[model samples]
Target chain A: MTAVAAPTRRRRQRRHISPVVWLFLLVPAAIEVGLVFWPALNSFYLSLTRWNGLGAPEQVGLDNFRELFSDGVFREALGNNVIWAVGFGGLSVAGGLALAVALNKPRRGVGVYRSAIYLPMVFSLAVTGLFWRVQYQPDGTVNTLLGAVGLESLERQWLADPKTALYAVLVAAVWRQVGYVMVLYLAGLKGTDPSLDDASAVDGASAWQRFWYVTWPQLRGVNTVVFAVTVIDSLRTFDIVWAMTQGGPYHSSELLSTYMFQQGFTFLNLGYASAVAVVIFALALLFIITYLVRTLKEEVS
Target chain B: MSAPAVTAPAPPAASPSTSHDRQRVRRRGWAFHAVMVPLTLLWVAPMAFVVLISIRGFDDIAARGTAALPDSFTFEGFRTAFGEGAMGEALWTSVQVTVPAVILSLLLASMAAFALSRYAIPGRRAILLVMLAGNLLPPQILLIPVSRITESLGIYDTLVGLVAIHVGFGLGFYTFVLHGFMRSIPSEVTEAARMDGAGAFAVYARIVMPLCRPSLAALGALATTWIFNDLIWAITVLRTQAKFPVTAALLNLQGGYVSNWNVVAAASIMAAIPTAIVFFAFQRHFVSGLLMGSAK
Candidate 1:
């Protein structure tokens, strides 16, 4: 420990950090800490107390969490979040990988196809939700199409029905997500070594075999990135859910995010909302910490 | 058009054109198109339907539901969306918040990146980790304190307050990306400048920033789309209708025009137009930026 400390101490003394470094770093650091970390820490404290936003918070040790565990709506929201993580993450990654592979090579009008697939990524979730809401209406696009296809029995009020509301919302969310994931995978594909592809082919490997053995392994870094993004996005999904159903139809579509918002803002149960937020933070930490450790290991080296 | 040369060299042949290889390539191309064409059409159908709905008259939509082909089209929806829906004012508000926020965030992030990458500052790893972790957390976790802080700062309900919040939150991801880019710049170049008596600030301003143009443009386009489309932050901080950004105003329009599909569609399109322009115009830089960030 002393041997390691001596060199770091000597190196630090040798390279004097200029005031300009401090000036440049501290300004942004100060604002970020004040705005983000400070608030986050305060929320952690607030979770352990009861507050109505108008008065000083009264201390309550873990009662909010205890109440959360027994709360039917909270349990529903938690269950829905897990479903979202699976459905959103699984479908987006699968669909995105297929799109990226198809668009990997230069071809006639590939750019057009790529752009057409990706254009949805730029739309705000509010727009996506509103647009899908119209389509999900009784006499809207979806039911109309179903009727035209002679599947009249399949037609339902997509967003209004408690059974279909969450899944319908998931379709819209996945529609937006696939394009972003496709872009990331396309970037990952560009870095794949072409020599390996030829070598595997020469060994009589089929396309599937070549891709699985040669290309898939090369995508470890990007897989880590995609996993991190998809999971976090699933956990924090609020805007589209908010605009479409607002966790409606008797909280059938409720997520931790929307529930937290309703509790904190609408009902003014600030402490309970903070507790929900803490749960979200803990769930997200599972993926965030894993990604960070890998990224930081690479960075520090 | 000249097809882009394949990156992998083709097998050695008697002639540059090999009919055997060409046949296989053609077959593969056909297979790709067979799969992609239908999928692309299906994927883009929702937005296309929205556009179609936006152009049709509300009476037409009512008579023949949204899935039907338009019997006639009009600009009536756009006009009403701009006028009664107040979408134009909301768009202007978004521009005000997004432009300044993106610029300030990039400026501050670039400076921080330069310092972190170039100088051996104390606890550099810790600082970067904090900033990175900050960006990953859900905004809802920080929602209450951010609201209270903005309220206390007396900037609540103002565009300036929204801009500050955007910059504060944006600093982390932007700084991380810029730091990766700056670190790749060879030390010899900065050393040469130092030998010529350039101070740290001068080396940064004259040397480092210009070298980061691609990343800046990419990040700028990205940040514009994100900040413009941001609904949660706008809703959390601003209360007045006039101060609301495009997303919030669009939501209001949706609530008001429940039966007016044309008008709501028009407003949604209007809200999407700016980001679409950015996406198309800067596609190359943004794609490269994604590549660059992942490479780090």
Candidate 2:
């Protein structure tokens, strides 16, 4: 049934005797598996003890969890991470959606405007946070601006007040993250069939009506992805908080990441930190799975 | 800011029978521009402060606050940051580790992606899933074994060790992503190249590499951002204080300091500049390719 193949004809298909390929593929994959498995497993082992990471670790199972529940600092850090998730993940998406819509309409200088908005997304979180630390100083620009605008009564210590500190970080966080969300939405918007908008417009639909009814539905999948990623990034954030306040004013701005670092390295409490790492891994995994499932469904459909 | 008049989004492109309708579209376009410009400034306002703060003398930073312009502009903060035993060396340390990590991974990932995308290997899909999972797992979970693994190999405090870790973690996501991009390059082109007796490497280097420029640039920028700003692994694996990356140098600006805000601010802008430069340089390819891949 198949084309009759001569013996020499089959043999003449050049041999793919490439040994280097095996080395290239297997070597990196092996390194990753080894690195990922070892510490992840070690963290679980360490979590069963009371190791300060320096000396002998006492084998005291469940005590760390027990103490963690009672620990005021851990509770505060958890609260702060939740706040960060809402602020960075929730607020930034909303702001990014607003800005993306506003800028999506083509106009003069729109490219410059788009580029400027996305500028903060490229900045290291530490740099952005460091700059904001100066901005939040009692005698800082924020205060000066308030004074200049005759709102001097509202000016106060931004980072020092526990009530206001985490919010201040979120303000800067939103400034950095909104652009990222805008870019994602912009990409989705580009993919959108513009004819649908024109068709709806010809039917006497207002621009707002077309966006709400037509454009928003097309953007559903992208929105799901943005929400999930923003949440993960928010939870894993360490650099910014560490840079500006170091979880200061009595651990007020502390998130799980910064708290884990302080406990593991600074205080040499490795076992506890590993447990916290486990928590972070679980959370990130949950978000990623949701994103993958939704995106995969869209691909299949 | 001048866009060379690309003829991108013009109101005149819209069909208009009446001049009033065209006029209405133009007004909307101008209104949209009005809103976005102010929003963009609010977005970048904080970064503006950091650059300004980096140039001020220590006395001015203290006296006038971060918002106020320097009374006498000077490069004193820059001098302090690059002084002996400061972030200047750390910045170099970051580059030394980052460049090799990025280049080597790009090579390995291209090879792997080529094979996985083009072949009918039974385990290819499963292997890709496993690799993607490895990337999804947080880096904090890998720090302990990475540290001990480097120590056992006797390269824990060296730049080589850091490079190795970056390459290791980078492979999973890099390979997974590059495979998708390689898949997008139509198979007809590679088949034609094969007819010309081009070997695997030639096909990759000549045909595939040129075509996959967007993906490669995106991957390079992604890897650079990751390795440069990474604080956790840098501090964990590099025990010696001086071997610390600039990201870790930010930590040194910590401790119960006797009020060192100016130096901290200066060091921060220095550490952030390389990435910002890269962003500006590859802004188009970096944003479009990456956002397309992820959002798609």
Candidate 3:
């Protein structure tokens, strides 16, 4: 019996310690390191130097960082990113939460409504940009509708104007994002125990009170996810802006992501671009670190 | 089984109260519909407009501005878009890149996810965090180095290069998602396979993989739409118009057809079709997958 049991235990140990696990991890790990991690690290090194695509990089030390603070466009880009983070993020989350609450009830045709709302999210930002670009034309659908409603004075060249360009893009972005946040919150609502809602109702809680005290707490997980996604998405907003206005009309809508792309690819200022990229990276990493800490703590607990 | 009983009206003595409650519920439901139906229509109106504009005659659009109702409908824009516009070629290029990228990323991600979640690997938490961070990092940060690397490796300006970059970048999110999914699977199933003398590969390929069909489908659909819709990587890596994916190609079409709303609208709608189809087809899995990643 001892011999049989010992052999069995040894076999189990061998199975658990199989080399295939290492093999499985090897290629993906290599790709991740080579493509993403290495490149990200290289950006830090590149930020300290001045290089065009064709020339050897010259080490400029802190000059790029110094210039970044003083550069007017960079300042504007940074400011726009902040506005984007706050405006787009706030609107999407709030709108999504509201929609989710309204749609959370078991009503007929709710699925159809949800799908229709989510349809825009299925299209690429490119499609969204073009669609809105068409709508925002001086005599386009938005203005036409406004005219029909006797609000012709309110209509303007939405994407062409500096003051409204970023907001215009933000509107299109919010259109797509609201659906994503709604779906997440909807999922969170589904997981919530209905008994708690019923219990609150029985205790004479009003609808708003029940939501504020009970449903809101239950949705905390989804709120964090929505907040993180919104922040990251706001930071990485490029495609729609690029497609719509190309950061044009004198760079009114320039975002950090778009600015970095222009610097690196268009102007070929690799080092300066790297500095911009590094700043963007730093901003994203801050939130990423916080999120990881929270998630990891949860995991360990 | 008891649903109908609870929903059914009460006895005659309580009929008046029950009827009043029924009326109020019905009114509330009607109000909900009143608000939701039009809001949903408004939400879908932009895409509906794209469809409406796609088939309109160019002459009609030019004669009367984009807001004008079409006097007649034709597939002239599609013909132009697919023919001289070369949208068909761009779409083909997109397919060439998206299909392999989705398949390869899913394959690699599932393998990594299986090991990280199933095995007692060292530094598992660190690995997970790194992948998640990589996914969250803006692609602009890696643009220069990755472009240079691709050029050095002789894959730059090639579809293969774009495919590699997409697979690499996509791996982070896919791995994160799959890791969540795989962890939720019962360990006993794989252990049972092990007891039957199945090797690690067999346990993964036969046992674990088969059980993960729902998640695989979900990720596949989501990734396909994402990679297909990708504009940045394609624009950065691919140079020639011949190699341009639909998204990048649409940009080119926009440049040429800036004045021609009909052709541009048609091309944009054409580019949107595949993703729209994929989203609707896998709607259930797609939503569940998103929730799985976030709600954990």
lDDT of each: 0.88, 0.77, 0.86
Q: Give the candidates in order of TM-score, highest first.
A: 3, 1, 2
Stretches of model 3 off by over 4 angstroms after superposition: A1-16, B1-14
Q: Chain B of model 1: TM-score?
A: 0.92
TM-score of 3: 0.95
**Candidate 2 CAPRI-style tier:** acceptable
TM-score of chain A of each: 0.94, 0.90, 0.93
**B194-234 in candidate 1: lDDT tens per residue?**
78988889989999999999899988988898899899999
TM-score between candidate 1 and the true structure: 0.94
Poorly placed runs, candidate 1 (over 4 Å): A1-16, B1-25, B292-295
Candidate 1 chain A minimal-lDDT segment of 10 residues:
A5-14
Candidate 1 — what's its lDDT? 0.88
B-chain TM-score for every candidate: 0.92, 0.86, 0.93
Backbone steric clashes in candidate 1, count: 0
Q: Would you list the clashing residue pairs of candidate 2?
A: none
Model 2: per-residue Cα lDDT over A1-301, one tens digit each: 1357433333443245245445556776777777666667887778778886566778889777788888899899988888899878888898888778777865568788888888777777777777788788887789988999999999989999988888898888888888889899988898899999999989999879999999999998888889888877887787788777788878989988888888887887888887787778877888878866764564346
Model 3 Cα lDDT, one tens digit per residue, A1-301: 3666656654565467678888888889899889999998999999999999777899999999999999999999999999999999999889888888988775667677788777788889998899888778786788888999999888899888898999999999899888988998988899898999999998999999999998999877677777877887888899999999888778899999999999998899999999999999889877777667766766667
Cα RMSDs, all models: 3.2, 4.0, 3.2
For candidate 1, list the clashing residue pairs, or say none.
Answer: none
Interface root-mean-square deviation of model 1 in angstroms is 2.4
